[model samples]
Target chain A: MNALWILAVNEYLDGLRNRWVAAAIMLLGGTALALLLVGSAPTGTVGAGALEISVVSLTSLSVYLVPLIALLLSFDALVGEFERGTMLLLLTYPVARWQVVLGKFFGHMMILLTAVAVGYGAAALFTVLVSDSGTAGWQAYLTMMSSSLLLGAAFIALGYLISVLVRERSTAAGAAVVLWLIVVVLYDLALLGVLLADHAQQIGPGLFSALMLASPTDTYRILNLTAFDSVGQAAGIAGVAARSGFAVSLLLGLMTLWVVVPLATTMALFQRREL
Target chain B: MVNAAAVEKVIDVAGAVKRYGDKTVVRDVDLSVRAGEHMVLIGHNGAGKTTLMKLMLGLTRPSAGRVRVLGADPATAGAGRRRALGYLPESVAFHSAMKGREVLAFYARLKGIAPAECRSIFEQVGLDRAADRPVRTYSKGMRQRLGLAQAMLGKPQLLFLDEPTSGLDPSLRRHFYGLIDTLSRSGTTSLTSSHSLNEVEARADRIAIMKMGAIVACGTQAELSRQAGLPIVVRLGVRSGSGARVAESLAAMGKIHRRDEHRIDLFCLGASKMVVLRQIAALGEVVEDVDVMPPRLDDIYSHYMENVQPQ
Candidate 1:
């Protein structure tokens, strides 16, 4: 096996053993199931489709939850190894610095993918079993799941960037939480506040779409809620989707950029790092 | 592998300087190790011993100068070249959830050794019985042994061990050094850093004493002792009430240190050792026993460190 594969496999196994990962997986799975079963009660009464309603709810859930989970899983990846003295021993082996960073990136990405698949996959299965939404519903749900994974990849990359930038595990953790708050919670709130204050003048559609694409969660929101007619109309983003003029390909490209740029920067910084 | 006819330089560090910002961790350090040589680095904490070892292993690039391990710059060496080097950090830590056997196998695969090779290495490091146990369950000494087991994998031509015996018991320490000895005999060049001077004194072929990021002294025990100019101590066990008499008689020969009423230690240069011993023999009945102590590595280390310290 390649050395990078070995390191990645070890990282994946190590991540599985962590109590926090287990808890996060459970939390996501349980919340996703609950949202599908209990939170979808209003869909039946309101005459809205169950899959459409759950899509909206689950997208919001992912926006808040997936990035947090990704950050939590990866914040300590690099700095923790350095603090624990494993990085020194690891670097001594016949492995390149880029291999280490990429290995860890893939490993953490796999963990997040597994969590999202099992957590959100089970919920999507439940929604499909009970609902009669047909192909369009399944399409939107699949897009949500895949785009959720992409959003997670972006955050995991950002977490690695934080891991390499900081000197201590505690510092990386603190930076990760702050980053999560900024991208997930505060960025949207601040943007909404800006849009609300500029209601008279109105933010331009082009500038508005660019601003939304700045945060991975917003891009994820736009992708899942705007990709389809039924889900987009139900989620109240159809007008924003029509005005934003973002193709599925373009939004996906932006998310890919989010994953690659931070990872590339992390590799570059880690290469020159003293440890 | 044990080609005694042709000597191979495993590690060559020339004028290597490592700086973290303005503070220099390793400065103008030049060192070389030959195949089958067991070199021990002794220094105080923060003496750049670990940093120097990192440079030799190519774990970190020197800010200036050059470091070549196995005739290639460690910082730029390819995977094949790096596969020939092994290192055990001062504090060895592994994934706590991993079984000892699994951890060794992973490292073995990274070093391009067959997974089957891990079994023998486990036995070699005395970690066979605990191979299936999780690393979290192992004690500190067990972890150290596990680290050694990994470092010894693939029969690395050059091994860099930083405080390899930190938490080992006396017997395990002996076993560890014996393993190094066995590997050395097989032409594996080993560079080990240690604070346990007395234990490493007998095993190390050459000792390099580092202080404040520089090699203040480097040589075999005898050579270092000669360079330090430290005297050998001869202690005499005198009969009761004869301590004062022996002290006065020994005072004329050389400097005398009264250990207690029953003993007096004589400090004499190497040349005057026999002359002092002959004088002590003439006072035969006054002295019951005599212990001629040569300068130990600890003494030589302290002497060199003291001389290097600014007044």
Candidate 2:
């Protein structure tokens, strides 16, 4: 346990000193702030809450940026250590291999969590101060922040899995980018293609929901845009939400599963690795 | 539950073999190091010195036999037992973003040592002045010192250092061996691998020479020199006019190699060195000077490394 904390703290400090974590925070905050100020201008004329509209716009932006940031942050975690020869020395210490994996996971997750909270929190604060938004708007904003953190964590876990499976950092980097493309862009496009081809109307709502739940990016989009009625209507996904008949708890659970499965597999594979 | 004095061998490897696919890197070999012993492993590239060290450190398990360090199988040893072992890899590295002080503190914490002790270690390695700087700015010598300092954390009972002095300056290499000697006096056993034979010649209490994935010879320098039966050379600096006369006087003593008019080298076995030396001494004014050279660690190493049969 002590070893785990030591390794985790070391990794976190490494991230801070490298300035990548700070860059990620600035990027998220700047983009979210832009969405809040410009994208939500029509909300006041329409008589809708400003934070609700900001949530809808931010979710769309986050689906692309958050996963990319997470992958960039963690794609080299294990393979970089191996290449630098640090992992060989580290394993000789008193720490177990699983502790090393968990410790790095915690550290990377902390960076992502902090970036999401501070970035989205700053944007939400601006909305609350400049606009007349109710408790419902605040609640939807908070859910968006937490769910965005979960989404980033799921990708971070996937990146770690890639790091452990590959022998070289270049291969891991390529694999991470390819993984992001397939899950974030190609998966949804393929789903649309299936829908377009199914002109006979054979695919049911249940199958569609199951397919969406399979990809973490889709699960995150559904969770943020459809969890609240105001946000769902503002984002124009209320009809899909109603057709799917999914619960908020189920989507959150699926995102958590995305984090667990890949991370657990990374630990198992890392333990058996010869380096 | 076992006392230090009760265990004769700090590290024991019995018929250990390691195979990756069809290639056997470490053959069936047995090696044992006593407590406080300084054992140096000398071999050529890909001769399995590093692989054997990995097997004993538990980083890689042997395919055929067992390895025990500090009275337990290193592969299955508990974390508590691991705290007693320290290892410095061939090319040790740190997170480039970290400062020197942070790197030591991080490893210290993982080893269950107090972070405060890292300050003195920096001083010990002459890195205190640069401790606050990022590791990316460090030179190769500084990085090598940092590797040594980290391996000394908590004064571990056993140390496995691979090419520990590869990047160190000559003076620092001397200090490193001095530190190892001090640790050995205080009951710390060290198993180090090196390609620089002369650097470890006077430092290693026992030497293990490996060839073709197996230990071909293991003993002290004198014992190995004796076992190898390599000839010692006696060079005589003769007067300008006495070279031929001196060579004729010592013709029956040993084989002679004449370099020029002034010098002739006599090669004789260890048993006949005294007789050969006395024969030259008896030549009186004919031989101007006599220089006796014993077989060096390099010669013994080559004798074993070259004469071994392919496995």
Candidate 3:
């Protein structure tokens, strides 16, 4: 158990000191700053609740940034140990092989948790100070930030699954980045384009909603919009989409599934691997 | 608990074979070790010593035959057997993220040493000062010391050390052999593999000379010399200009090798001892001092290794 926890702590430290973690935090911080300074009250725009805007923006921020960081954090988990010959030390211990896998999974998760706390915490603090919004917006922003952390953790585990599945760190890193891009960035883009073209009229009710929940990032977006109905009213289509089925409870369930399933897969693969 | 009498066979390897693709790394080989003995395995590079150790540890499986470590087949050895044996791998790296103390305690826990003994064990290993620092900050020798400490865990009955003191300096190397000797006296069986053949003869009670996946020779140092049909050379130092004349007379009278001007190596042959002494006295007055052994292991090893090549 000490071995397990130590490994986890090391994984967490990797995230704290890693350049990728800094980049993700900077990207999120910069986006929050830009949103506060640039995105502002339009002429004659009424009913702009600070609560609604902050919630919507944070949801967007975490969905875009957290998964990217989480993916980067987890992709090199086992390969690095194997390449550097530290695996021999771990193996000499009488600890069962399964413990090693689960321990590593927990360690990488702690790192993901730390990253979300630091990056999202900074964003929230910045928004509260700069945004002219009232207490209601701050409350909504906090809620969005908390849920986004949950969503990010799910994908970080997903990256761990990929790392264990691939034998090389470089390949795992590439696969993780590609996975983040496809799932977080392009999945919504493709869905939005398809919905606008013809699928929006042709699809069954809640079909797009069902497809969107397939992605934890999309589920996070949906949860955010629905949590702040005022934002749902303004953004029109996307706002309404966010307000629907993927509420907090639904997103929680999906995110939990994301965390467990990939972590389990990684453990299984790790147990059977030669190293 | 095992009966003390049954410990004569510390390690039993029979018909062991390992193959990677078309290459047979280790072929059918049988070797055995006994209790309270310091056994050294010596071979040239690519001789499969490392592979054999890995097989014994169950880090790699044998394609054929059985390896019984401490009387239980390593492939089928339970947790109990694994706990009794301490293994030091060739490249024993540490978890850099962990502090030295943390690493020691962690390994101690795995070895199932009671928590109360952890501090003493750490001190015994000479890692008390740098214990709090992360292993990433440790020097290479420090890391090797830590590896030694880990192998010393559980007071291992059968210690398998692969290049155990590779990075250690002379003083530490002396300290290491002292530790091994102490362990030997305590009745802990050890099979130490090293490339330094000359070095092992000093520490090992018995040396198993290996070449190309087979044991070429196995016996005590004296037994090996006798097997190689060579004499154990004793150096006799004499005084002044008479040393050279004494050396020549001794050589003419009996079997001897001239090492230097003042020194002559005496190899007793099929002759009476008084004859050699009389021959020495005939040349000049005998020297007051006598050095019995003059580093005979190297000469014997080179003789045997060069003479016999394992198929």
Ranking by TM-score: 2, 1, 3
Candidate 3 residue B265 Cα shift, in angstroms, is 8.4
Number of the top-ranking candidate, with lDDT as the measure: 2
The reply for model 3, stretches above 4 Å from the true place, is A1-3, A9-52, A118-151, A165-172, A186-216, A219-235, A238-258, B1-10, B70-85, B95-99, B109-127, B132-134, B223-296, B299-311
Full-model lDDT, candidate 1: 0.85
lDDT of 3 by residue, A1-275 (tens): 35566556655555554455566667766776677556554512446565566566666777877787677666776777777676765665565556666776676666555556676667666655655654545555666767766776787678878877877888988898889889988999998888889743987558877888888887777766765666665445454565464546767788789888887887787765553
Error of 3 at A226 (Å): 5.3
The per-candidate TM-score of the B chain, in the order shown, comes to: 0.90, 0.95, 0.84
CAPRI category for model 1? medium
Which candidate achieves the best TM-score against the true structure? 2
lDDT of candidate 3 over B1-311, digit per residue (tens)? 66564477878899898887778877887888888778888777777888888778766678898887777776545544577778777878877767877777667776678656667766766778888888889887788878878788778888889888887898888777787787778888988898886668668888877777777788888778777876545567877566766666666544677776677778864224466656555654567456544337777777767898766
C-alpha positional error of residue B304 in candidate 2 after TM-score superposition, expressed in Å: 2.0
Q: How are the candidates ranked when ordered by DockQ, highest leading?
A: 2, 1, 3
lDDT of 1 at B47: 92
In candidate 2, what are the lDDT values of residues B10-61, reduced to their tens digit? 9888999999999999998899999889999999888899999988888888
Per-residue lDDT value at A134 in model 3: 46
Lowest summed lDDT over 10 consecutive residues: which window, candidate 2 chain B? B1-10
lDDT of 3: 0.72
lDDT, candidate 1, A1-275, per-residue tens = 88788888888888777665577678788998987787756564434466777889999999999999889888998999899888888888889889999898878877877888788778877887777764347777878888988998999999999999999899999999999999899999999899889967668867887898888888899888888877877776677767667888999999999999999999999988876
| Docking class of predicted structure 3 | acceptable
